[model samples]
Target: MTTSLKLKDLSKKEMLLAPGHRMCQGCGAAIVVKMVLLAIDKPVVACSPTGCLEVTTCISDYTAWKIPWIHSAFENAAATMAGVETMYRALKKRGKISQDISFVVFAGDGGTYDIGLQSLSGAMERGHDMLYICYDNGAYMNTGTQRSGATPFGASTTTSPAGSSVPGKMQHRKDITRIMAAHNIPYVAQASPSHHLDLMRKIQKAMSISGPKFINILSPCHRGWRSKSDDAIALSRLAVNTCYWPLFEMDNGKTQLTHTPKEKLPLKDFLRPQGRFAHLFRPENEWIIEQSQTQIDADWNAMIGAGAGASGVIEE
Candidate 1:
């Protein structure tokens, strides 16, 4: 039987990620963790690399995780999880273990898009039975908010400050979702915390499938983004509404748009709330907004042309 996602039922599940951690107030990563752990029906062993989520949840002598969790380095989360899963399979083959367990690796943008990219690619290439989740908050928010590969174009970071010399990051954000899809993994998806049901459904779907499954979720960092802590959900939803982050999945090799904006909002609506892009509002930098929008339009249309919306929308 398929796992039911009714909110009432989900709320009854034991909280795998307990509260009282040191995650920045209103950090979306915490919400992502809760949603992911709640959706899984089987016992899961999760691996989190050294980042905000890891440091905050697995503090000295105090752990917020209820399940078996592993703490990996900033650059080896995927590799570590791969080894764990490999051993489980090896032991099960020898009839040393009987219970079915799920393996998951959760990392941030810095760990997934840049630092851990090599390990992540290797894990997927090897076809390990594990689920990798990237809660992309754009920059390296955990460590002084440095610029990361996943940081959006023209968004200021510590390394790419919006100053007279330069205006935020000059290059566009790297598309890690497509990179993972290129591996022909069993599942690859991009979701957001604002769509709780959609995110939970995707998690459950990934857990059901064997082999490496990747889900890239857009999370919000209040301190880094200079936005109101309470605006995290609205900011996340604006990303989807602006087409900055589409809710889609690549099942096998086919792409499907899970949720498309009913009426696409302007990119400014997404950027206006965040201080990272505050400079873009200046008269001199107005052209940057134009360029960003043009690029976004092209990418969205290309996805449609490439069959992203071929199967129809999943509806948020």
Candidate 2:
């Protein structure tokens, strides 16, 4: 059963991720971190790989996290968190630790979709009791806006710049959520910061469930995406409304759609706000938008089919 939380239920929650950090304004990653931290009531040990969330939150001689936090390198957050969880199990078995703790890893697309996949896959395969989240901003935003495995097709980035000679990023973004689901983990979900209740409910659900859990969140980057800082949340909503970033979850290999748009918006509505896809509006590049729209529709339809075939309905 999916538990529902009212605004009053969360009013008294502790602020685990403190403010006054240097994360950019309207940063989706920042919003996701804070919300994820606040979603739980149990003690949590948080881990973050080297990226915007890390460098901006933890600086020399200070920190923004109120809970016990560890800063890992770009490729080791999953491994680090797994080790910690294992140690906790051992200690509890020995009667040295009595308190329950949730182990969580917060890594970016570069850390997760690219460098950290090995450790991540291993952790899930091992069936560790933890929740791993990837705040995907679609690029290696911390490293000069370079193209990453999560970068969108035809989007301009530092390494995949659009020009007359070539189109931006010759490939589509990798489907990490589907890849995680393939691991046969207990829980796998795709969420956005714009939908707070949905995201929170998923987190609460993960907290109750045992075994490995994963949440892939669409974290918009203003600098990398070349969008207005204040537009991050709205852009996130548009991404969901267009079905570009579908909200779904897979439980025990069953698929469920969390939020479906009543009238799915056009792909352009989601892409037009971000400068990364600006060149696609050119006469010569209009075909790219059409191609993207076609692909989005196909993917959405396939997801719906999967949801119907194997239901992940809350067992309330």
Candidate 3:
């Protein structure tokens, strides 16, 4: 039998996002943004770079945002947000904008892992008091599903289309969470819409912390992944279970695994459902599936070591 729960139980008692936004149906990014907003108890100052979320929320003059928001350039979201927060700090000292505001920056994989990597690294290194969220939909969905650095292996995007000679994206996703952790930021975590409570908890904790915090959210794009809108959350769950995306957190300078699936699913179970990787099952394309499974196994082992703190890493 199926059970039902109220939205209130699944989310916080706050409403920052209202109706009339243009996000695609079952867009994971929207749910992520809502969770972030709900976790913030103070006035919020959010900056979004050019991406799907930005375009959907801010059309000509119509804005779906209730918080103080800004739309910055496509590649400088972190730099711009850090500057805004620095100015806010300066302004507060001069009795300008109040000091009760929380700062947050929303970036897509194209903006964070590809174009904005340097800027993002700089902000985290400088220890800015802000939350930078990378809504990784695996490709540049807003720009027509082009491959970005964060695109997973074998996913067929516009730029990396499946064809006679070429398969899809050539590279595995960048290890963004580890890159953030390397900066020695106070907090860094991976989250997804499949685990609402865990996502909300991490956001609240990150907000309470006092340095730069990064949250990498697995945002499933229907158009990019070529999947039905309803499959977004299920795909997210499959990703975690298959070890394609492991949920974990780094606090101060230690790593800890947040969630481990009870029943590990096969890589094919995850790959077969998405049209982006449909070519992998085509007799000749089976090697891609084998490669994916091998990578998942290696990654799972790495995560186990990272979690056990056997490599001199402490548990966060």
Predicted model with the maximum lDDT: 1
What lDDT tens digits, residue by residue, belong to model 1 across residues 122-173?
9999999999999999999988899999998999999999999998899999
Off by over 4 Å in 1: 310-316
TM-score against native, each model: 0.98, 0.95, 0.92
Q: Candidate 1, overall lDDT? A: 0.92
Q: Candidate 2: worst 10 consecutive residues by lDDT?
A: 307-316
The lDDT of each candidate is: 0.92, 0.88, 0.84
Better of 2 and 3 by TM-score: 2
Ranking of all candidate structures by their TM-score, best first: 1, 2, 3
Per-residue lDDT of model 3, residues 112-176, tens digit only:
99999999999988888899999999999997999999988888989989998689887888899
lDDT of 2 by residue, 51-97 (tens): 99999998898899998999977788998999999999999999999
